[model samples]
Target chain A: MSIPDTTLASAKALVAPVLDDTSRAQIRAERMSAFVRYTLLITVGFLMLYPLLWLVGASFKTNSEIFGSIGFIPQEPTLDGYRKGWETSTPYTFGRFFWNTFLIILPKTIFTAISCALVAYGFARFEFPYKKLLFASLIATLLLPNVVTRIPQYILFRDLGWLDTYLPLWVPSAFAGDAFFVFMLVQFLRAIPRDMEEAARVDGANSLQTLIYIVVPMLMPALISVALFQFMWTMNDFLGPLIYLSSVQSFPVSLALKLSIDTTEAFDWNRILAMSVLALLPALIVFFMAQRYFIEGISTGGVKG
Target chain B: MARLQIRNLEKTYTNTFKAVHGINLDVADGEFMVLVGPSGCAKSTTLRMIAGLESISGGEVVIGDRVVNRLQPGERGIAMVFQNYALYPHMKVRKNLSFGLRLQRAPKAEIERKTAEVARILEIEPLLDRLPKELSGGQAQRVALGRALIKQPEVFLFDEPLSNLDAKLRASMRVRITDLHKRLKDQGMSSTVIYVTHDQTEAMTMGDRICVMKDGHIMQVADPKTLYDRPANAFVAGFIGSPEMNLIAGRLDGNSFHLGAQSLVLPDELMARLRANSGSVTLGIRPQHLRVNTADGLRAVVAGAEFMGHEVVLHLDVEGERVVAVLPAADYADLDRGTTVTLTPDPGQAHVFDQSGGNISLSTSQ
Candidate 1:
């Protein structure tokens, strides 16, 4: 029939272009489009990275040279900034600040990792009385402004005689005070099929064993994300350490970086910038190493209705 | 190997939505029992309760000599293969198969040997080092079954294990699983299998006894032949066969079954049982049992015909009621649409159900 032939002709006509499209003009147009897209992406990427590039470049410049040029390439590069930055005016060296920061960050990361995972596991896997209400409260805490609770929390800590210690910073993490990580890990946990855990339970594993063997191993990517995030956040936490740590010896690198600038004396711009660059290294290394896990953790699943 | 007993098992979710009513079942040691039903029939829920994956609202689950209602899933001595296979994506096949044994702190060499033995049996030896994601769907299902097999539990619960597979793969896997059950039994391994599926074909092919359920209640439980030959009610009669039994609403008068503009004399035994409460009833006949070209039969018009290679299914209309009849394709090759034909139900194969769907033979109460 003409109807059948006409339908066949139209179908073939629609598909013919894709099958035979390698002409020079088409190739040039495609290449030009791709080239434009890449060029735009690269320009945007460079603009975003310019501040970091400038910081690293200015770290090696003299104080006067840093102000002279906003360009990344320093006129004359020197290690004097590094040398001077490493030696704090305090009797203790910058090594103590680095060590103190680790003391806060390592424990904080471990605590946040364990507490958040446990809380997220509870939220994701089980149905208990008031579970919905409790979870809603947890999410509500995510929306709560940190400044709203800051004064009351400080007063409570002062009442408990924890005024000038890392306890105030790392202790709350033990209770799963960071709701964002708990929420992210919970989403990752919920994405996993319940059958695996059921299989584990049937295989004779207890609740804790199921969590450790079945849930934790599958939750590794999200856990790594939680730890990486907690580490980066605690490392860069200036206000928390500044508020609690009174003694110079107890000061973390965040407080030490701010302490490097004597307002009465010259600003010591190059040394401060050099210390800032040094501070950025750990976070940078961590992010690059486990960035894949961080991205997978947040984007995997759990938003389905 | 153990006899598993579920007495009055019930599951009620929060907000008072009942997924499973009280269900009673006894699965003998080495029995291959299949729970077959449509979606929302609570077949999966019943299987989950038996596996201890779901908490029972009210029931007693006894495995062997133990009342395991309060016991944990691991303590129930059952292993389940889920519909999605539930293979741990991170673990290698060897690790997934050996996880349960390792969890119990089994001897390392024993775990290795058992893992290798199951891998060899399932023909997944080369896949021992590959992750679950690396395996195809069929391969992952084999690994999931291997994980359950290596445990050597008293009972194996399969929740639509082949539903995720393609038709060809599903057929092959069905045979493989049945063969595995036979081999395990022949080897004196006491393996009781309880499988659940929404497909009646799977139930008929794989189950030693099929339990047909609907709306959280079992309609009937019987072997494939008995279920096909004699269903307890209209639901079972209609559900257990493909193209479903043609169930037409009718009235059962003293000695005749009357439809819209058609009537058939009732067989003596059916008439004797159904004469008591002879108001509204459903007359059921399998498509294969409805014969065309009978000397004295109801008149029908051939509405459509489907040529099914060996057989041609002719959709016939009697007055306004649609009835289907299967005829040898070669013999009925010239049957045309809109042609008039005579259709009759084989007297011995017809089924009559009361208004409430209970079979006339079994329900004689007025």
Candidate 2:
């Protein structure tokens, strides 16, 4: 018994060192794999972000330095681009163009949210005579290319004497012309349980009241996504404003960016880059501010169903 | 005066699948009636119809003096507590409680008073500022109850309100709801409740009277005592009790109950209570009523024995039929598996049913 006990103790002592050595090896291997993974991720991420970084860096450079070096950093940064870019060749400043963009975005976003939510709610919850057919047509419009309707829409806007105004851009979205947003909201609404809506109805709320008090609050995330998409899209929309507004006073940032190129024989690279950065600012800021809800809306709508 | 009456309530889906056959029921004012059934039994559908959430294909749902079949849910004068609590996710508990009153454009002071009163009664005052998601399951359920309570509607509907809780919480909530109903009644408030659940324990404990349903039809409607002591059919007998009432198929000739290869002389009391003289029958006996190790009883082989602290549940095989007998643990502690024992069912507690699933022993037993 004593010999067996001694042998067992010796055997345990021998196995302990081997186990420790293997675990240490395993830890080192895990650390190596993790290091490789993070290094690869950081490299790819930086590569994808290089163009935006270069844009910001080149905006501060002089026109000569912007063309002279492939590197982003400038030897001497100056505020010349912003100062000169603000006062465009056109009579109005960049401020006027930004304001014009805001005017289009504000009504477009607000109306899109309201109109899309109402339409989505009806499609999701109600039973109408032609509901299936109507919804199918709505989806069909989503699948149709925007170019297909451009000529017809331009003709209609021209006949209405709305070519020189922002009505063509704002009126359609105000009437839920963005079928994609409506479809997104409808899908989101379908994922939500209707217990609270039923509870509201039981609590003496009419259909509209239930929509306002119960459905809208629950749909805030999806609604925020719709508003953000509309705001960004309208701010960046060049073709819609170009086709509708031919006047320099009503040019938005998207069309205004092209004004400098069209007016000057030799392009001032720094000024254009500066205004491009400023034009990108509103969309970037808004996207960051509402990023949490945007991701949640898309993910929950897709995954839960 | 808020008596709810359903006259031949029917529900047929658009696919032409008839979910509910025309069934009539009458629930008195202030009665705590429970609709209990297995899954797919349309108990929840019936409750939804009463609340006007589901379209009644054919029926007159008369609440008080009004025919509410055509009324919207909000206009039906009924408030419902849903299974998932259904508290407004965006509102605080106070707002949730006062939503119905605010919708009615009641006085601001009245809304405040009612909100506070309901909060105090449900013991959710501390959670008044919390959102529905922040509250625990029990707290959310209380808030849901307060939402319905504050409405002061003519009738209240609950669609398996406690089913989402764990077993322990469900048991406690069952008592809480029953106590709340009693408290409201004592205060002379109109608390006509139509609660639905599939758990028989909840139906047995919480309901003033239970309406047992099966496949969209009412199987039996009786107090818990009558439902247990004398189930109207084999389905009710099998569904009501734990370990279930043993329903063994056998035949009866004269005064002898022939069970497969064995036979037992029927008790005089049972023989007198029999509706049919001599034909095929299903013998229904509760586990507790089966006496073990009697000298003059039918022999059974003990297939299994579970020692449950104070009691022992013996799974026995009697003439190729499995029967469960619950006996006192102390007396049967030494009983081993595959042992032979005699089981004598108490004559007074045993029930006999005919071929059509109707209790034949109930008439003379009562």
Candidate 3:
């Protein structure tokens, strides 16, 4: 019995090395697969980002060198594009157009945040007469196409003698006219518990005071998301300003950028690209600064509600 | 501190479902009254109506001398602590405590003093600068309590404030809250409190007087001792105790109570206390009062025996009905299942109920 047990122990020792060898091979294969996966992902990610990179790089290139080669690298780098772009073909520089854009965006973003929050709070919390009908109509507006309302809205603004002013651009937003934003905020508000609001009421705060003190602070993340979206969308809007502001001085960056392309006989590709890169900066910077809240707001609003 | 009078309060939803059916309760100043019931019994709804948070459908809520059915919750001079400890998530503990004072436009120095005082009372001074998210569950609860206490409202409403805590923490917080109430009363402050909870242990331990509710109606309002000793109905009998009072369906005739084929002679004291003499009845016996292995009693088979350290709970099957008896551990070493035994219920502690569920064995002298 002792001799047989020694033989069994030797046999077990022989099998242990083989098992270890197989596991080592498996580890090697897993490492190789992970390397291949990361390589493929990096290649695809860079491919998607190449256009933006090329735009930024080409912005620094001389006008002659911009279309001369497919390579993004500038053989001759110069600030001539920005220099000429800053002094637009029109009398007002790009600074004036940027300032004009800011004027339109400030009130529009601020008003959208405040008005949508109020409307969303009412819809989410209170029960009023015809509440269901009113809410259904509000959601119906969400499904309605923007083009369907553009003509009637333009006619209304024209009759009001508001066609040549920024009032036509931002006044509607102050009244919670953006149904999409109102819907977003309403869905977000629905996900939040109402105990805090009730506590505020029990603490002797009236309805308006509750809205201002408790509701607004808790709604900050979603409100920031709303403001960010409104800011970026208004900054990039071309048709609204083009239809309303015919004056050269009143034109925003969007229409002003178009004016550069339209007035000149030969298109200055480098200058347009440079101005486009500059126009994209504000939205990009603001988004990065508020990236955490923007993601949190959207995810919580969508998933929970 | 002011008395709260809820008169014929009703709550009917838009779907025409009546959740609260005109219940009346009067909480005296400085009394810690608890409204307790199982889920869907509208205890929270009743408390909300008193706080002026829910609209009164058919009754008046009087705080102090004023009818506050038309007043806002804030204007009703009341404060509430929610089950979730509804501290303003953004505000620090100090700001949360002073929010009511700030809303009232009180003097800054007064707000500071009141905030500090409340923080100290709740032992949350060290947590004053921390946001609600930073505090632990127990700490957050204390901060929520301070928020209510700082208001010093005429009445305080608590909606299962400690139900979220673990068992051990819940026990500790229960004592803390009752102590706080006593301290406030001793200081001559207006400390009328209406607390709502579904946990019977919380209702039994903390309430000055408990109001048991069922199906949107009050079952009994009595002190914990009286509620245990003399329940008004079968529902109250089964609800208030931990192991629950075993209610056996039987008949009482002459001086004997019949359990199916078996019967036991009723004591003169129990017979004298009986309001109904001869009819179908429920014989209510608490587990502690049921004696096992008695010579002259109802014969039963031991279905199960649970060793609970100091005591053993014997689950017995008497004929076809289930009965439980609590016995001292020393009395029974290890009683095996299927063993035959006899359960003798103490006559003085037994209760008899008529068909309509009213306790018929309650003596008017008690």
Best by DockQ: 3
Question: For every model in order, what is the iRMS?
Answer: 2.7, 2.1, 2.3
Candidate lDDT scores, in order, read: 0.88, 0.91, 0.91
* Residue pairs whose backbone atoms clash in candidate 1: none
Q: Per-residue alpha-carbon lDDT of model 3 for A1-305, expressed as tens digits?
A: 26798899999999989999999999999999999999999999989999998999999998888878888988888888899998989888999999999999999999999899999989988989999999999999989998899999999999999977999999989989899988988888887888998999999888888999988888888898999999999999988999889998999999988999999999998899899999999999999999998988777763210
Per-candidate TM equals 0.92, 0.93, 0.95
Alpha carbon RMSD to native, model 3: 3.0
lDDT (Cα, 0-100) at B81 in candidate 2: 97
Q: Which window of 10 residues has the lowest lDDT sum in candidate 2 chain B?
A: B357-366
TM-scores of chain A across candidates: 0.87, 0.92, 0.91
TM-score of candidate 1 relative to the true fold: 0.92
Per-residue CA lDDT of model 1 for A176-249, tens digit only, reads: 99999899888888777787888888888887888998888888888988899899989999999888889998
For model 3, residues B1-366, the per-residue Cα lDDT tens digits are 599898998999989999999888888999999999999999999999888788889988999999999999998888899999988988888899999999889999999999989888889999999989898889989999999999888898999999888988999999999999999999998899999999999999999999999988999999999999999999999999979899999988898889989998887899999987898999999999998878788889999999999999989898788888888999885999999988877869999989999999999999
- For candidate 1, give the DockQ: 0.53
TM-score of chain B taken alone, every candidate: 0.96, 0.98, 0.98
CA lDDT, candidate 1, residue A69:
87
lDDT at residue A261 of model 2 (Cα atoms): 95
Q: Score the docking of each candidate (DockQ).
A: 0.53, 0.61, 0.67
